[model samples]
Target: MKKWLIFSILIMFGIFNLNEPVLAEAGAADLTSEAAVLMDTQSGAILFGKNEEVKMYPASLTKIATAIYAIEKGNLDDQVIVSKKVFDIDGTRVYLNPGEQVTLKKLIQGMLINSGNDAAMAIAIHLDGTMEKYSQHVNEFLESEIGVKATHFVNPHGLFDEDHYTTAKDLGIILNYAMKNEDFREIFGTKQMKWDGESWDTTLLSHHRMLKGEIPYPGVTGGKTGFVDQSKQTLATTAENGPLKLTAILLKSEYKKKIYDDTIKLFDYGFSNFKSSQVKKGEVFTSGKRQFTYSADTFLTDPIDEGNRTVDSNGVLNIENREGKVIQTVELKPIIKKKLEVKNTAQKAEQSGVLSLNSIVGGILLLFAVGVLVLNRKQKRNRRYRSR
Candidate 1:
């Protein structure tokens, strides 16, 4: 009996573990390039890519980090001086001539929108006393936030330096992280923006096909474009449609147009390949308080065995996942009935099993006690009859 009890307890443990919800692995991507990636903004699902981890010169793509750092350490309205060193920066200048006055905010717009190498230097000079210190700041950020093992930097502008290099995968990750910030999303998405009495726009409007209505994607929401004769035409582009947000990063395309073609193709694949399904809502779900919902076809991997799920009309849906283990319960202060209805509706189209373990133990205990009583009675009757 003791051995049987031990075995039963072990089986109970197995049942408990079996009821846990298992998570699925991330989805993979398909793209043709030296490196590339696509992901659902909210889901963190990797939709597609090729050679994503290969390290290469990021060129002006380096400005994404520069832009992010400036946003954090420098205020938008803060005044910044354009050092003589910063004003003379070659390649993609926001046209910052020597002694030119500009606000930190407008400089950021210049840096991001124009891919200004000089803006990077000016912002760096102001924040850390020098661009070198600012680069150190970016390096520390890379280690803490990006978890990039192979990335290093020598400049904020992403000009090719032997010491400056990053993996395509890491750049994609940084882009995603940056896009979530409202400041970044707002800055990178604009086709044309002016700051501090300085005008900035996407370089050479002829380069952007979206401006010409060439790509069918909703429109370019925001992103940086990159190139080094050696790095080829490296492009990072993001687009928004109705409910979806997508980003693509490509390195070293053969033709300039290839950058545009590849970006649009990746976006098309994401928007076309999967339907935007709402998996969860962050809100408490009051009045409209459903945090999570499943479609009619949504079947719980394990179904509830008993109790059609009871709510005291408080709108709390109490559901048991087959093992009498509750999987989901929501209580909304304003309406508990609505919570119950949602719980019931979620389980409606699904067939589930009944809860299996409660009464068995109770029945066993009762039977054992009864047998002990009967045996004692028999022994007492035998003793009494013998005495008589």
Candidate 2:
């Protein structure tokens, strides 16, 4: 009896342990980079962040903004004349001659695929006529169009200007915005392209190792790499697995391998712990007496377990992680109560009208019956009198 009781207790304890929810493994503490961020592209949720808001040099990542801006603002087919100024710019170059004429589209391709500073200078000059003007216009465009607040660029090529700095969170925002444009996506994902420039003729290759398959990470869609003495090494990577799309930004890493490792870690954490949840169009959520709904279908990321959703009285939906930190917030439109009230009022009026009509009909029938009965009685009396 004693042995059986002990065995039963052990079995019950094992069952309880199995039923308990497992917490997600935290990855931020394991990263070696100075600043990093992981964002869900579908819902714009930050899954993991470490020093993400600290301003640091972006290095060559500035080309990403320049490329997207040019794609949206400049015509692809327009012939852009290379100036002598581009030849003097230091760093990577497509080696353009003084008067070499190239299409705006090709220059953008060279700048992004090969990280060519010369190509970036040419695009900047062609679009806004001078580097200073280009900087001013691009800054305005970033703030007004892309909605970035913490990023500022002094030049097109992120060569090393103290004034040109952006945080990891801001870079993540910029990359997410750029990935929305189809043309930018195509160029950004290109591993290698044939370059038929005026001076330099070679196959331009992407510097991002994972994107080029050198690191061999699954679901890597696009990437951008940057490096300078001050900025160290910075990387932007985008990946997708089923419904979950992720963007990772790593800044100020000392070595190339470490940044890539950090990126893989970030991706693994995101894919393993989080899931994409869809809120359908017109899906209604209630908070006390107020009802709110989304006008269009929306996707959001949440933890696999222990996640909570709460709506405030103002109809703001807050998605919280297991720790109760709000990872994302969305403003939901209030469902108008007046329409329902009007519908109920109309129903009540129709019912009242029906009742009134029934009462009137019943009264008329009763009066008719009374009149007939009286007439019948009078006739009977008259007949009796005649008989007598």
Candidate 3:
């Protein structure tokens, strides 16, 4: 009986372990890029990372920053005169002549869609007055506005400047911030555009294979590709599946196709294993004595098995997976409920009433004592007068 009972207990333990959903061994495999990152654009969660913070050359991916900066700072309707220095820029060109005049908007399209170094130069010169000034301005903008620390730029056209470097993680940060601008989003996702420049009149096509549909990727919204001897092959791609928006960054890949392959793997991992989980606006969560409600729908990319999220008194929500790894942090706006305020006031009033009653009783007792003493003194004085 003892042997049979022990065997049954062992069998029950095995069944219990099998019933539990075991978390797959963490991290992705077989990515070829030297550095890669997959990020949820909505929640800014790094789903997968491999040397993402290590600095690498950005190459023409620098144009991603230049395009948005020009759109924000320079007037699109303003005509930019192509300087002679623009013609001297190395790599692909829109064949701009020294005195050619092009609108700032058209130049942005050429630079982004056709990867035109000439157009990039004209835009930079027009915006910041000189390449040196443009480089400084863009670097500051990247740090201050986009919150990217691991990035630096020396030129608007991503020529191989030794100082020009960025990390895959930083690129994802910049791209996510840039996508918020309506004008930038339109230009970034554009697959092709017509060029009416003085030297080149052909249609400009985006060099990014995924964006151009040369390489089909599901739900591909936008992409940018970069290459140089120093940077090797770098690619940034953004895609949306259902409510989840994802950005994938790959840098310093040895082979060109390897970048695309890495991006696909990142996307698959993000979309398949994770989902956009939302805590609706006004959903209440308690932290310590304070209760906080979601100011807006807190949309987060979470693992499918993410059990419950907790909000702290600091108004930060922690989304944790089943394995208890915190995957996302959301800063929520703290709400003040009128009922709670009223309750606090009522409690204060009750305490105030107790204090007031104590004061009244003490004042009454002191007044009665003083009256009794005065009366006694009057009686004593009357007795003395009558006796005399």
Residue 189's C-alpha lDDT in candidate 3?
91
Find the candidate with the highest lDDT and give its number: 2
Residue 93 lDDT in model 1? 78
**lDDT tens readout by residue for model 3, 90-194:** 898889999888889888888888888889999999898888899899999989887998899999877887798888889888888888888888888999887
- Number of clashes in every candidate structure? 18, 0, 0
Q: Each prediction's Cα lDDT score? A: 0.66, 0.90, 0.84
Best-first order by lDDT: 2, 3, 1
- lDDT of each residue in 182-214, candidate 2, tens digit only: 999999999999998767789999999999999
**lDDT (Cα, 0-100) at 364 in candidate 2:** 100
Which window of ten consecutive residues has the lowest lDDT sum in model 1?
Answer: 295-304
Give the C-alpha lDDT of model 2.
0.90
Report the number of the highest-TM-score candidate: 2
Per-residue alpha-carbon lDDT of candidate 1 for residues 33-60, written as tens digits (9 for 90 to 100): 5677766554334556576778888888
